[model samples]
Target: MSATPSSKLPPFDPRDPLGLDDLLTDEDRAVRDTVRQWTADRVLPHIAQWYEDGELPGIRELARELGALGALGMSLTGYGCAGASAVQYGLACLELEAADSGIRSLVSVQGSLAMYAIRRFGSEEQKQQWLPRMAAGEVIGCFGLTEPDHGSDPAGMRTYAKRDGGGDWVLNGRKMWITNGSVAGVAVVWAQTDDGIRGFVVPTDTPGFTAPEITHKWSLRASVTSELVLDDVRLPAAAVLPEAKGLGGPLGCLSHARYGIVWGSMGAARTCFETALDYARTREQFGRPIGGFQLTQAKLADMAVELHKGILLAHHLGLRMDAGRLRPEQVSFGKLNNVREAIEICRTARTILGANGISLEYPVMRHATNLESVLTYEGTVEMHQLVLGKALTGGLDAFR
Candidate 1:
């Protein structure tokens, strides 16, 4: 059988997907269609309220629904995941983020950061212990690597894990800016061992584990960010992720999360672009719709062009990743370029909308605001610049 119209391949528009490509198999089409409709109906109706409330009220339920749709770690081949291709995973991120970045962050952190770590490094037993529950969203998970003092430089972590009197590991340190921290039942925490940085799975109920909510976030307001305190927190030796050692482990997980950002940010741009297109066609200026004006059309054109480039870039990267040939630097390229361009697109779209852009009634300003966080997190633009710089030059001047 042929692919669906949504894949945007040959017989589909090269410049845009436009739901005309037979690229995605019928199953993928169905998945994309399902998420698109769900986001439009379930999320759009209540998104403004959630945004205003500064919290996702029905997130557990929402997460469970996503799990049912095979969104959690959707690209991973097994472990109750969707077992979708990388493109499908990108599509899922796109749909979620089109609703809101915070919504997408919830899924991305859970799937790419938390679940990918376990799936990549967890033992079969550990996988069996937690994957299914997390996949179902019955239990939530978070990744903790960025400490209060160690933001960009995670390797300088002070969170320490030492072998205890009985062979268990006792952890002590603070993890800040953690997503899903307050609600996570299980957290994949990184800490310094004698062997360098290692990750551990700590149950939130662990005696000394406490995560207090970090409030007043002007960005990603609908998502939860918090501080995780490990005061003599202890875990079994089995809690250790034996498959990984040193910074490579968490960095690997970050590469996964960064891939999602590449698509997710573009999703935000798509929303802004679409909103601006509609506004331009309607809001009267001078004697006709502002879209008639050269300046307005030019702004819309730029948004469209940049959005298309971002989409194609992400799709190409997804193709490479599916083939197991993608690199960290490539991810850095996508994350950095797409977010930077998408943010500009949203800002441009907002400017065309004039005052209405800042209103919650329109999507551009919110996407623009959320893009600020997206630009900084998952390795900042500068970090990715250095990553690419190192790729091009034999010299390593990132930190030095």
Candidate 2:
């Protein structure tokens, strides 16, 4: 006998028109909702003022709250981490970036960059020293890989670490545009060594180590950007991340961070899209709501398609990451497409909201501005394109 068709299906949601919710497990929804509510309660009301003031006041307290929620290092195992799946972490990132890219930058730098570096490459002693505190957000951490003159080309970094007569590592160089740099208790700094590139787990308070906060940023103004100066910073022999040798260590951490951006950028886009949708439905033009116009509908339709498509792409990458089968090239694909698309979505959203879009009263302009920085960081669009090009072309060298 033929089976009868199911009589019920979930009602359509305009916001999530593609019915993407069905793909998430109950646990996923819980994680997403928890983060969403946290951001709604904690970030939404204050973000405008914070963005305007160009500061993230009470950031340490925010970190502690994030830690209490098991979000600081949500995906890593042990050492006080929540050990949730990568997808859960991605969902949390989306929610965080939905509120503000700066907030997500803070978490991404902490968990994906700093903590992951130590967890994946540091010795047991190093892990025992830092991970638990970092995971608990009792100690904030920063990753130092980008230098003033060397961003895409980390191999040419000017930061150098040398062994002194006492066999201690002496670090001297600067890392620029570092997130959480000024507030970080510890910095996982990468520098050139005799052996090759090495990562040092330097305590921020160590003598000769200083992170001076960078001011006057138009993009991601709410985030702390700093220049980490290592003026003959001395460290014990054990300070080096034992397993992290050469460029691969930092690059690996970057891949992980970029994966989060793949999801996080979409979060920013989602917020902008929702804000525009709300405005279009309510704002009247020529005695009719703007939503009634075909032009407005087309804009909304295009935004929805790209937004959901980007979300779907992010989810697919998250699953790949969880399965341990994700490739660097695949990550490049996601970062390249998602960040670019996310920026476009934000821009389109601004157009929908018209003059009000530029106001900090709405999130569209803020997200758009924040995404400009996102577009340049964690491997620029050009770098990702080259990466994908090499992969697709079977190892053709594009960069000379």
- Over the stretch 31-138, how does candidate 2's per-residue lDDT look in tens digits? 999999999999998999999999999999999999999998789999999999989999999999999999999999999999999999999999999999998899
lDDT of 1 by residue, 1-400 (tens): 9766765645543235453244567876787788888899879898877777888888789889888888888888677877888888988898889999998999999999999999999899888888888888887899999988988999899999999779999999999989999999999999999878899988899999999988887788889888999999989999999898999999999999999999899899989988888888899978899999998888877778888878888888988999999999999999989999999999898888899899998887778888899999889889899999998898667665
Overall lDDT per candidate, in order of appearance: 0.88, 0.94
Question: What is candidate 2's TM-score against the reference?
Answer: 0.98
Best by lDDT: 2
**Model 2 superposed RMSD (Cα):** 1.6
Residue 384 in model 1: lDDT? 92
**Number of backbone collisions per candidate:** 2, 0
Clashing pairs in 1: 5-21, 8-21
How close is every model to the real structure, measured as TM-score? 0.94, 0.98
lDDT comparing candidate 1 with the true structure: 0.88
Candidate 2 — what's its lDDT? 0.94
